[model samples]
Target: MALTTDTLRIGINKITDQVDPMGAHLNELDGRLGDGDLGVTMVNGFKNIAAVSDDLPDDFGMACMDCAKAMTKVSGSSFGTLMGISLMAVAKQTKGQTEIEWDRLPDLLQAALDAMIARGGASIGDKTMLDSLTAVIAATTGKTSAQDALAAAAEAADGALIEFFDQPCKIGRARIFGDKTKGMDDPGMVAIKSMIDCFT
Candidate 1:
């Protein structure tokens, strides 16, 4: 029910295993609006994270910091960098804690969202992963059970894609596509959904 280094390791392993098969699909989705590297960034990022998961410390903050560093080592992709930034924010908030209650999930996500906003210059309505993260935070708030929180997070992230599917991306390289970006799912949002699905 509580988040520990084991939880982090399990999640990273799940994501790494689940996301590999999604690489081509994600690349195709991003090709329409971005550099077609989103899939690579995600797959490699999680793989790298998994590679270091076993060494994660019980201190949640240090574990998160290590995870963030692993994610950033994948490449110079903006998505990878943002993922690192989000994890860094959470690491700071959860520093020194070996076991975090599920109720704090929402606050952690909020910290991530705020950090991503500040670092990536993307807002909630920008149709990015930030929006998906915002949805997850709203859905998981007040949840004290890990099972409930995971379900809420997965459902909310999936819903975010549906909600923003018809909307044009408002930032990043996707914005350059302008009207064409309309009706296209944001790759980052879809990535969040896919990653969350692994936890379920």
Candidate 2:
């Protein structure tokens, strides 16, 4: 089935609900390496997105574009900017489409991933959100259905978090901590997993 604006809104709500309670934990995680406000930034951004979700256009791409704008507006952090950029990239690629097809999933995912990489200058193993996002793209590459793909993506993201626990931060403010970041799960990756889980 094609993804609709209503369905997208539902997914966003699920993600926000899942992340809301974890905000404090996420902030704690960030405190060990980077700015301790990651959780608040993410929660605020999603809250802003939710506020405008009801009035979004019926077109899926346009809705995504609006969400991107809302996210960037409410959260001026790097994480928020990356999220907005990813959504904007998805909007650009899916332009005019009211729904997405299974076959089109790879392209959409790639577009978002590429945008994040370009804008954030981070790659896999960088201990950033890109690590989990890259895993999601890889795991969902051969999947034929949204349910299967999203499940795979969620699992991949979870696994990435496990691996990230032993790795040191390589980019962003977290990198300054060096070895101190070792054994700590990257807050960005954790957030990615949480978001992906909502679709599973």
Task: Indicate the residue-level lDDT of 32 in model 2.
Answer: 76
- Provide the overall lDDT of each model, using Cα atoms, as 2-decimal numbers: 0.89, 0.83
Candidate 1 lDDT tens digits, 1-200 = 68899988888778878787777788899888888999999888888888898899999999999999999997746999999999999999999999999899999989999988888888889899999999999999998998999899999998999999888889989899887887889988988888888877
Sum up the clashes in candidate 2.
0
- Candidate 2 residue-wise lDDT, 85-176, digit = tens: 99999899877888787757777878998999887898877888888877788888878787888888888998888878888999888888
For this target, which candidate reaches the highest TM-score against the unseen true structure? 1
Clashing pairs in 2: none
- Which portions of model 1 miss their true places by more than 4 Å? none
lDDT of 2 at 40: 87
